[model samples]
Target: MAATEGPTVAQSSPSSTPLPPGMVLGPDGKPCRTCTDWKSWSKLAKTKKAQTQQGGSGSESAGASSSSSAGSAAAAAVVTAGAGTDDTAVNATAPDDCPPDREVLGRATWTFLHTMAAYYPEKPNEREQTMMKSLLSSFSQFYPCGHCAEHLRDEMKKEPPKVASRMELAWWMCGMHNKVNTMLGKDEFDCNKLDERWRDGPSDGRCD
Candidate 1:
């Protein structure tokens, strides 16, 4: 549903803290943590804190030291939140009940989409088909990540949703998911496993 273009650095005014390069901003032009990976967000926060402290203090070196200490402490907390030092890591399991990051949001949205596809009627009536198309259009318009929503809209124009049948919808979703995965440099999932993964469970009966 979403794709990534590589990140570029943000420019800031002299008086303001410089955000980390590659930090994505929301529609309001403020830093968007949910739109960014955990590593980038953490770096941006630490940089901003350090810059603020430096501006406030008499001794520049002392301010730097204090900033480093504070940054380290905050990072430690994140580590405890189950995010290791990986650049793509997200605090999905954070103890403080933090909001979902981009990756977490993607996973949840994909789950919903796949499950919906799995249960779709084999022969949807015209009204049901119309409703499904409307739902997808609305979803594309209102998805939380603006860029992601835009990407989905563009992709939809290129290849509209195939919602005529259950299997048709399921394969379409798998193809879309693979497109996203390819953009993110991830391995493509096997579309053949769709029912096994989403509806039928494994042949091994482990999920049963």
Candidate 2:
């Protein structure tokens, strides 16, 4: 089978040579493509021959140039794949591409959840509270990304959802998101800006 790559992997750091050797695998012992970013998965499939050719070249400048060119070409290929109707590859999309990957999907999901949380009533009646709790519980159970869902489930066990008020829920969700961000080695977002970032625009009217 001809291998196609993901968008993120098309242009990777030098430390990620050849293939992504550090990808986390599932209990099935295969790469969890849904949980793993497209870039890492794409790296794993790069041809050994091309890697050898780059390594064998003597000139550092030439190798660097070649690598950059290759990365651009890979990015283009990813863009093309994303636009096309090909179902083989996953998570290789340009800005205008189709079939969003894990990263894009995650961003979209978080946006929706945060917005929903922000709009939640400050004092929800019992029925509203129960429904909101059920929705979150269902999300943890049925999130498309299995490993992600599992992590959420485990986190929920230790720290249950705080649905007392909109502000409380938003803060609680922000904290939960930060935990995941920390796990992924991403910088923690300031919970103080949850309203500015998610609900209200920044004070400067920049968002307007």
Model 1 residue runs over 4 Å out of place are 6-15, 59-96
Candidate 2: residue 125 Cα off by (Å): 0.8
Clashing pairs in 1: none
lDDT of 2 at 52: 45
* Alpha carbon deviation, residue 205, candidate 2 (Å): 0.8
For model 1 the TM-score comes to 0.78
For residues 30-120, write the lDDT of model 1, one tens digit per residue.
7776677666566655555544554455254764776665665454444433233454554323334667767778888999999999999
TM-score of 2: 0.64
lDDT of 2: 0.65
Give residue 182's error in model 2 in angstroms. Answer: 1.7
TM-score of each model, paired residue for residue: 0.78, 0.64
Q: What CA root-mean-square deviation does each model show from the true structure? A: 5.8, 11.6
